[model samples]
Target: MPEMLIDYYKAIENSSAKMLEAARLKDWDEVVRCEGACAVLIEQLRYQSQQQELEPAQRKEKARIMQRILRNDAQIRVLAEPWLTQFEHLFEGQLQVMH
Candidate 1:
């Protein structure tokens, strides 16, 4: 396909959407798994991007896909705040004990 680059972006977006759903469900393990998948997709996208360029129309579509991914990421972060705080506290406690 001429727009294989766009396909990569779409795949990343889909993974991000799944991550968002997992975050909503408070399924941290699932979110982590999805995050790993997203990292792989992002690496693949980066490699593919270096090898190919998107057409002007595909570039626009890519921008839209990126916006949605960012939106999903923002929401996921918001949802994870409580968990992050707890994790930070755990680390802080361990640090205090070590000291």
Candidate 2:
């Protein structure tokens, strides 16, 4: 059976939530994995959207899901900023060592 548009929204939301959880734990790998999943889901959602539109109720639900996803994303970014800065410094140090 073909996937429903609402299902895609739900899946993306789930991935986003997982990303937030992983970020809270400082598990960057898991966060990356979930981010990848969200990317794939969002791409699929875009394609599926062209082929099918959500019902009015589904559209409302999608809006709610999107809101949660955005909130999760904000939290993830806040948690990740410091880790990303540290990683960037480490990478720069490694490059200096090579030189």
Candidate 3:
């Protein structure tokens, strides 16, 4: 596989680990944040894969796609914290009731 592909996969793996850890700790916020980060990374990888077939003349178009991917990733990361926090609270409440 290409170096880019490897790197992308590594990012996803790392993000998944983090998310799992957060879930184990019942840290809903962290889990959500990590998951969001993973999602963005995956989307970026998807975009990059699509650009791999483009011709040299389409460099600008590829750049635009990359830019959009990056922007979406950033946006997701920004919202991750709050979403995770909310998720954690809900999860905790449910767990408490189960006891």
| Candidate lDDT values, in order | 0.92, 0.91, 0.66
> What is candidate 3's lDDT per residue for 1-99, written digit by digit as tens?
324544565667667667656655667688778878988988887887776554554555546555654654464555455766786998997899999
Model 2 regions more than 4 Å off: 93-99
lDDT of candidate 3 at residue 59, scale 0 to 100 = 55
Compute the lDDT for candidate 3: 0.66
The candidate with the higher lDDT, 1 or 3, is: 1
lDDT of 1 by residue, 1-99 (tens): 224888989998999999999999999999999999889888888888999999999999999999999999999999999999999988997899899
How should the candidates be ordered by TM-score, best one leading?
1, 2, 3
- Tell me the deviation in Å of residue 85 in model 1: 0.8
Best of the candidates, TM-score:
1
TM-score of each: 0.92, 0.88, 0.49
In candidate 1, where is summed lDDT lowest over 10 consecutive residues? 1-10
How close is each model in CA RMSD to the real structure? Answer: 2.0, 2.1, 11.2
- As a TM-score, model 1 comes out at 0.92
Query: Model 3: runs farther than 4 Å from truth?
Result: 1-3, 53-99
Give me the candidate number with maximum lDDT. Answer: 1
